[model samples]
Structures are given as C-alpha cells and as structure tokens.
Target: MATEKLRQANTGIRSFWWWLQCIVSLLLTALLVMDRAEWIDVPGLQRLEWQAYDWRVRSTLDGQSDSSLAIIDIDERSLFEIGQWPWPRTTVAALIESLFTTYDADLLGVDIVFAEPEASHWQRHWENLVEEYPSLASLPPPTDGDQVLANTLSNYPVVLGYYFQSSVQAGDPPVIGQLPEQAHLTTDSLLSLPEPQRYTANLAILQNGALSAGFFDNPLVDADGVFRRVPMLQRWQGELYPGLPLAMLLALLGQPQIDPVIGEGSGVDQLEALDVGGFQIPVDADGSALVPWYGPRGHFEYISAADILEGRIEPGSLKGKILILGASAPGLMDLRSTPVGAVYPGPEINLGLLAGMLHQSFKAQPPWIQGFDLVNLCALGLIIVVIFPRLNAPLLMAVSGTLLLAAVGGNVWAWHQGWVLPVAGLVVLLLAQTLWHLSMNLLRETQQKRWVAEWFGQYVPPQLVKSMVESGESFGLEGEERELTVLFSDVRDFTAFSELLSPSELTRVMNRLLTPLTGAIHQHKGTIDKYMGDAVMAFWGAPLRDMKHADHAIEASFEMLAALERINREFVAEGKPTLAMGVGLNSGPMSVGNMGSGFRMAYTVMGDNVNLGSRLEGLTKVYGVSLIVSEATAKQAPDWCYRRLDQVRVKGRRAPLWILEPLGRWSTLSQERCTWHAAFETALDHYQAANFESAAQAFKELGEEDLTTQIYLARSEYFLKTPPPQNWDGVWMHTDK
Candidate 1:
C-alpha cells in the first residue's frame, strides 16, 4: 500500500515542495521543447516516434477501408492484356471514358502524369510510309491519339495528376504544360505555404482540356523515405494549387470557396488549417497532413483496369464511388514505401488522404500539442521530484515503473483521439530524473549507515544499533516470507472534522492522536509501516521476530484504543471535537521487505492477508465496531474474546473469510457479552440455513441497540419477506471498495 503523505500530494499543488517540483518540471519541459522547437527534432526521436506510430496503426486498423472509395488498378494482369504501360493513348482514353460513361463513377482521380503527348505505334509507322510513298498521302488520315485522350478528359469529371520538381537541369525549361488557374487557392489571407521550384504538369492541350488537376507529388515524405505525410497543397510563383486528393475533394464538394486560415500574432504567416464550407482540415504550416492508413495494401477494393475496358466488371457497380486511377505493376515504378507496406502502391497515399479528410479522421499535430505535452510533463515531473526523495529503493522502482507506464499509455490514448503527443521528451524527463535521484539516495544511505552511531541509538533498540555498529554489514533489507500479524487503523469520519479545523489545528490534532497510537504499537514491539493522515498501519514479525506476533498486535490495538479514549477526554474537556478509530488485524504468512523504488523504501508487509486486514478495517464502519480481525488472527491469539460477524468474500479474493470483532481479553470478558455472542451465533446459523423467520425473531430478542444485532436483524427481516434460492451458500459478496 502507498503511504498517506504521498496520497495527500495527489490532491493538488498545496506545498512548497510540490510547487518547486512544478517550477522545475516546467523549466525542464521548456528547455526540452526549445530543443525541439521547430521542424527539427532531437537526434533519432522523430524516427522512433515514426516507428511507434506505425506499430499503432498496424495494430488498430481492422483491415478495412471506406466503402465509398475504390482503386482502378493497372496491375500486372492489366499490363499483360493491354501490352505494357504507355499503351496507345486511345486505349487510355477508352479507360477514362468507361469510368464515367460506362460505370457512372462519382469522381475519378487519375494518378498518372502525361507531361508529353503520345503517338500510337500505327500512327508513327503510317507517318513513315507517308514520307516514303507519295500515294500514301491520299489514304485516309489516322486519328490523333493525344486529341482523343484530351477530348475524353474534357468530357468527364477527371482530376489528372502532375509531378513537381524541387530542381531541374540548368538548360531545360523550368515550367511545363498548363497549371490549374481557375480553381487556385482562394484565400484572401497571406500564408507561408510551401512553394516548389518547378513543376512537370500535363501536356498543355490535355491539361487545358481537363476538368481540373493537382500535383501527384508527395513532397513531405519522411527522412526514412516512407510516405507518412503528404502535402495537401503546394505553391509556385505565389500561386497555390491543391494536391491530388484535395483536388478530387474540391470537385466532390462542388468546388466550394477554399479558405486558408493563417495563424495570428506571429510574424511568420503560417497556414493553420483549410476550411471548405466549414469542413475544416487542420494542416501544418506547409500544408502537410498525416496519412490515415486503411491498413496494408488491398484494403481498398482493387478493380483491374482491363476489366473496365473489356466490360468484364459489373456495370454501374462503381457508380457514386470515388475511384483513384493508378497502377500497382512493379514495372510502372509508381510504388512507394509506406508504414503499412513496403511495396505499397503510391495511389493509396492520395486515396488515404482523401478518405480521411472526408471522415475527418486523420491524426494531427497542431500548434497547441506542444503546450499540452509541456503541461503533462510538468505534472509527471512534479510527482517524481516531490516523492522520489523520501521513498526507499524498493518503492522507487515500483513507483517509477508505474509512472512511466501511465505516461506512455496516456500518449497512446491521445493518439487514438486523433491528436499526436510526442512521448520522447516525457520519457527522457522521467528516466533521467529517476536515475539521478536513485543514485543520490544510495550515496546518502551509505553515508548515513557509516555514521549510524551518532543518531541511530535514539531511534532503534540499543542492541540492534550495537549489532549494526559492531558488525556494520550484519543486517540487510531483502525480501522474505514469514508468519506475521498485520494491522490497519483509521479514524472514523476524520474528513468531516478535519475540514472544520484550521490547517495548523488539524495538524496538531492529528499528531496528538497519531503520536500515542504509534507509541502503543511500539510498546507492543510493532513496526511502524507509514502514517496516512489520521490512519496508522503497523505490523509485528521480523526485522526482529516475535513468536507471539498475533498476541502483540492484538494487545497493541487495544492499547491504541485506550490511548485514543484519553485524547478524546482531553479534547472534550477543552471544548474540542473527538473522533473514534477502528482497527483490523490478520495473521498469516506474508511477504515482508524493504518495499519501494531505488530512491527510498520502508519495511512493509504485503500479501492477500495484509490486504484482507485493510479490507476488514474498512468494514468497521459497516459493522459499527472498533476492532475486527480475520479468523486466522483470532485463531492465532486464542486469549482474545471475539464476536463472529460474517463469512464472505472480500473484493479481490475468490474464497470466503470469517470476519470477527474482538471484544476484550478472554479473562476480562463479561457474562453478558458471552451470552449475547452465543445467542447471535445460533441466530446467524439459522439465517444461513434459510430459517429466516426464526432467525429474525431470535435477533429481535437480542435488542436493536446493539449495532451487530441490528445488522443481522435487518438482513433476517428482508430474507423472511423474500426467501433465498435453494442453492444459496449464505456468503455475502462485499463488492464495495
């Protein structure tokens, strides 16, 4: 169990220590963020984040893509049937015509760039014959395939793709065919969108004749050559043009006026997001977006391009479905490495962006994520700084592991919410600080041990100190399992009265109450585990074994009750409030050790029995008793007189435990308590046998003033009205924590 002082820290930033940790954490976070302030990152962290992102996507995607989208694959089968890529322009035109005129596709994004016109083999051969023979000129002229494809583009809804170049040969023309001028970026606000150096677009006639077009280039590919982010828009000569997916969406959304949102209060005018009729898409300053993958290749339905031309596909089956026209054939060289697949088709990048934008599902790292990460780092750092110094080595390891696990888990959960929070800085902060504090603690412990003679005699038994000082390495704090007695005590309704007192007054009152209780535990040779507000937990066993651990623990619990009564009397005389406390004890084989992380530790016991003792303490309120113990404890210390309370399973365990309340020493037990205890057990047995009427009558005869009798009376009356099932075992399942 965690100490109470640490639990108090979780409430808020209330103390100077807590506030200092916050300031320190904030400053550290600021420095970390400063190191990663812009597009640059610290060393290999960005690539590690990429790996983390890929693993997350691969794990969560259900291998399904949006049904509204499909891919027209120019695969190997299509290449065999159509006789290699760069097929006759007429055949390409036929494919385009079939997408709209035959299948009624809602929109088509052609992922190929036609930078130059293509002449059919027959047309080239016929031209040679005409130059070689004069009579050939009289023959009917063959069709111009480029004109055929251009006319086909003009006749349908097609956004033809184009490529962009960051640099070109010195002599070559930097500009190519037509750029889309009519549907250019319409935002009145000035923005710093990426402007490439040059572009290789479609042939002028084809580009001019098409409905619209966008760059097929993925200018924002990662350093690892993986297509994780693709630019949504690009600029050249102060003109903005949407990418392929954006262009198709614009065509789908009826070409709404595009709005480029620019960040304010900053000298650099960066684009924050793009708004098309209020369908907002958060974009990076340079208009890049993380690709929302639909899983590996073939997630989206793939239709062979040859099937469309040959009429083998179902007619109108693709109607109203957005189709991306591209190739998967390795010879085409249009494949790209991606997170989901190494041999992924390039068209899927555009397809993913398109689908994600429509669904608003793409994960994003906006400007505010830096602030979120900073704040979270500050909180985590505060926890580590404030708590690490006081904990033992064993507890330091446990707490540090839990804190890091929670930080990483929360980061992943945020990713699922479509916000990307970088985990690298937080990890660095936790691990580095833990190691520094842990090392300092070990050094401090060694120095303290060497000087044990000065301060140790007053705290521990003189013999223990003498043994330790004589043989410096005589004791160790390793783990061991032994039969022991555990105790848990808490002030009843302490929160109610504690809220009524001033902070200083409450502190004094808690000290007055806790000091004596701790003394009583020590008087009976018990080890103090830790203090948690008004509660005190202690145990008896090794660190100096006592064969009568259960007897000592029970005697200590009685002594604590006597001490509390004296404090209450003094408070009542002084016109101050008084509080009652309850304690629970359990005796069994429990694992005890120096429990904590490397920073600090405390000798504490832990096991199912220890937990049961704590659970029994909580049940004190339910049973309205001051002392309770498991049957194991009552059995071990047979000198105590106990009233059997209930037989039931606690929250975590599967088996049942017999819970009982200790009255007093057997020698001091009154005849009245003995008679009452006998009467209650008989009634409880009858109730367990389903004889509710007899049990209720017997419990009523025992009187309602007694809280224990009241509990059974209430239960028996209820069961008398509604009989239990025949197979009921009469064990109550206590589910409350």
Candidate 2:
C-alpha cells in the first residue's frame, strides 16, 4: 500500500509538472503576439557623426552673405522667350552687357560650363548673324562661344567655372590654362606624386581663358549625394588652388595672401590647411572639403532669375551682395535627393557660396562628435543589456521612449543652435532595439506553439485551443492581474425545455442556439472562456487589452438580442418553444492566467469580479430582464445608454449592487426614453418612501413602450400585493428565480 501511494504521488507530481510547462508556454506566446502587434515603435538612432557634421556647417556659415551673384536660368520661360537653347553668342552677349551696364554687377561669374563649342550649324548661323549686324561687333569672338567668351573675359573681372575630374588614367594631362606660378610645387614632392594623370574642362577653352579662371568645385556631400558645402581650394598637379567660393572670397578680400599649413606625414596622410585672412580652413589630406549640406534641398534663399534680370529689384539689391549664378530650372539636371527634402533645388552650390560670404557659414568636421557617437552607442547597449531586462513592461516602455526622445530632441536642439551631430548611428541604435525585440517575440511565439501542441491537443476546436494555449506564462511561473470585462449568458428554462426532446434532437437544438450566440460574442472580439451546459462565460479586454471593451460588450449584447429574435422566429415556425437568454456583464480587475493541475491547465480568469458577473446573470430572470450589468460596467460604457434597474444585494454579497439594463433602441427612442426615465426616477423616489400607490400610478402613466417603465410598473404591483411589515425601509427583496 505504501508503494502504491508513492506511485500515485509521483503520478500527481508529474501531472503538475506537465501543466506548469504548458502554462508557461502559453503565456510566452501571448507576450510574443502582443509584441508582434507593435507594443513599441523603436525609431533608429541618428548617428552623432552625421549630426556633428551638420552642426559644423550650420554654425560656420549660419548668417553669411553673398555678393556679385547673378543666376542664368535656362528655364522654360527662358527657353520659350529666347527660342530653344544655343541662343546665339549675341544673345548671351546682350545678357552680359545687361548685368555689367544695367545691373552694375562688379564681377561676372558663369555657372554654365561651355563644355564643347556650340554645334557647327549653330556656330555658322551665329557667324552669319554677326556679319549681318555690324552693331554686334562688341560681342565675344564666335569661333567657339566659350573660348571667344574666355578671350573677352581678360578685359573684365570675370571668373570662369570648371569641375574637378574624379577619374584618372595614365598619360592624361591637366586641362590647359594659365597655370599658377607654383602649379607643380608640392609641400612634399614624394607624397604629392600624382596617382595618375587626369584632365578636366574643354582643353581649348581652358587654354584660351587660363589667365583669369577658377574651378567651381563644391565637394561637401552626405551619405546621399547632395551638395551642401563649397570647398575653398583643391589639389591638382601637386599644387593647391582655390575653388570657386574660396576664389570668390579671395577676390572679395582683394585676393589676400594664401598660406598653407602642411602636416608632416607620408603619402595621402600629409595634411594641408589654408589660412586666408586669419580664417584657417583645413582640407582633407587630399585638399578637399566636404560641404555640410543643411537639411535636404532648398535650405537657402531662392530669387527668381527672371525677377533679377528684369530690373524688378530696387536699387542696392546687388550692392555689396555676393550673388551666385546657377539653375533652379527643373530640366537643368542639377536636382539632388536629400534627407530633409527630396529633389532639393539644384542651385545649392550658389546658395552655399552666398551663405558663406554673408554669414561665414562654412562646414567643418569636429573631432569631439566622433567621441560622442561612441558614448551614445555604449549607453544604448547598456540600456538594452541591463536596464531593459530587469524592468517591467511599463517601466521598459517609459524608459525607452524617454531615451529616444531625449536623443532626438538633443540632436535637433543642437542643430538649431548651429551644431551638427551625427544622427545616423543613433537612428541605427533605435532600429536595433525595435528589431531585437521583434525577433525575440517571434522566437517566444515559436516556443509557445510547441507548448500548445504538447498539451490541450484536440480537446477544443483548433482556433480556440490555440488561443487557450497561447495565453500562458513568460520566462518564469509568475502571474499577473489584468482588468477585464466578463460576461455570463444563460438560456432561461433550458433544462426544462431539454427534457421534452430526445438526446439527438437536444444536441441539434443546442448547436443551433449556441452557434449564433457565440458568433455574436466573437464579433466583439470577446473570447469564450468556457461553456457550462446551456450557458456561456466569456471575457474581453484580456489576452489583448482593448480600450473599447465596455463599448464592445454593450454592442455585442444588442447584437446577441437581435440574433435571438431570429432564432426564436425559426423555433416558432418549427412548432418548438422559443428561447429566452439573460446576459450579465461587469468590468473589474481579475487574475487571468493558467489555472489547474500541471497536466490539465486552462487559460481563464478568476476572482470576486468574475463571480459577481455570473451571480448577476442569475438575477436577470428574477428581474424579468434580458440583459443586466453592474454600475461599474454601465459607467465605463459611456457610449451606450443604460437604465438603472435597482440597488440590491445578490447572494454571497454584503453590499447592494446597482444593476442596469442595456437600453437597446435607445437612440430611436430618445424623446420617449427621456420622458420614461424622468417618470421612473419619480416612481423610484416614491417606492423607496413606501408610497406604493403613487409609485404605481406614476409608473403606469409612463406607458408601456420602454422596458424600464414596464419593469418598474411590475415591481410596484408586486410590492403592493405583499406589502412589507412596519420598519421595512421600502427596499424590495427579489427572491424567485
């Protein structure tokens, strides 16, 4: 007998163990599903390096000014007004005369490059036009308009534009121009050895205008190719020369002396810093400046070319103003994509030059921002590894949101204050947290599916059974309390009715009755917790927390009533007794988790709140009502109109519970309901004062359209028939069920 007892005890322990595992698996699955439904939206951390880069550029040139700028727009209007492109050298000459004589422009700068001479056909036509019109003799020589223009440039303070060649090949020579005196001079001859020879610009044009020319090379770019900064100087043929902006600055400052500070290093590591009028500008070892582009495109002043050209501006518009000439024309192919703006205006280089001159806003990289990035990454890693693991869900969410906001806010603040912080890395960090949490949730769900398969196999329908299993525990066996709206519905007199039918017929009728009712509950996203014979117990706002649980329950109640009417109609046609059901709904805190022995666990709710809902269901029939809810449920369901039934203490409860009935069709009966409610309130006051005759008369006068008035009338009649003894406080006791 001892051995037998030991075996039974062991079996019991095993069952418990199995149940615990199953419960744990189910809970984890619930968490996984919740997480999958986007409990958190983790934003990628913006890298500090990129932010710092932005800051440097913004701070350096925030309020700079530009002068001697003119925009030559090849706009649609220009195309329409001047007749398609290649508008003859005479037309361009006319534009130049207008800028010089009419606008009093000090320096003329051309953003347009004369890459190749005009087409032979156009060149011949231009030559013929010049011959026909002797007045056009002042125009630039027309062999190739660019070179002809270049030759004419020597007489004026003209700065021609050229771009740097990024690709190099063997034996290629630099484009011919009047080479600077120290063009081939290198700070370190060995280190400055050209990787390979490369050339830029049309050679003939460069040669013709070599005396007074500048390279229009704007090099500053972000990860996405967009111009934000104009490098002041560049290295070509082992010698340093000023870029267009720097050259313009030099010209503005009377071509001030330029001194180079070279770092003692080997190969491309050798550094150079250009000192112009006390401003020290560092070029990458290769003599390049990555212009810091402000957020996206169009981050600068944009004046229309037509407006400027047509003398639409007042006097002094170009006075001491450093102007830039570039295209905002969409067809110019200068548009670039950027973070802040897509298809940003392509006249960004000219804008940058103007900004640099006006506000001295030049972009530079600061060393400290790199350190800040490392610090940011470490901090995020600590949160993910330490703080996140220990904190509960609410705390975790709060901390994560706070940290993300702080990072983003700090970066934006710094940027507005003219400090560029790298944002890409921070963006990456935030994205990592979001991705990691999602991945972990998916993993947890897979584990849950395995646990569900092991237990509760084939016991319930696949969907319901899966739901039951997925609602289990997390890493450990700890359970949590959640607020849920519980519902208990029962078909009145079902037992008595069942006796009239055989087992087979009873089964068929039961299925027909339950199917539609269950469908109504599911429509409101309520889960069926369990079904006792002829009764259903369901709950909402758990498994998933729905803010609209109260509304959903009320809506489901009305729908269920409608469904019952249809069922009853069928029953009447078949000569079967129609059925009536009562539903009790209450919202309160309950412990919802795995409950039972190890081998036979169920995901269900428990507590006094759950019990109260079931007890209220039983009182529905006694009150002659189809649906009843506690005061708590009625108050929570603000969207639905409810009529108070009475204050009564249910069995096993000490305090009186305020009961309510779902006022279906209340919207349609708005005016009538108002009158009936007012009459019911008066009747309630009189009934409580033991004035049964007055209360009965008031209730009867309410007419019988609304259910609440009918119920009050019935109560008054019952109380009058069996009047309470002396000292009775007029509270009616409902006993029959």
Winning model by TM-score: 1
Off by over 4 Å in 2: 1-272, 276-281, 284-484, 499-502, 546-551, 587-591, 607-609, 638-649, 665-668, 699-723, 734-737
The deviation in Å at residue 323 for candidate 1 is 0.9
Model 1 poorest 10 in a row by lDDT: 6-15
lDDT of 1 by residue, 629-692 (tens): 9999989889988888988888999998889988888799889888888898899898888888
Question: After TM-score superposition, what is the CA distance of residue 698 in candidate 1 from its true location, in Å?
Answer: 42
State the lDDT at 546 in candidate 2.
64
lDDT agreement of model 2 with the native: 0.61
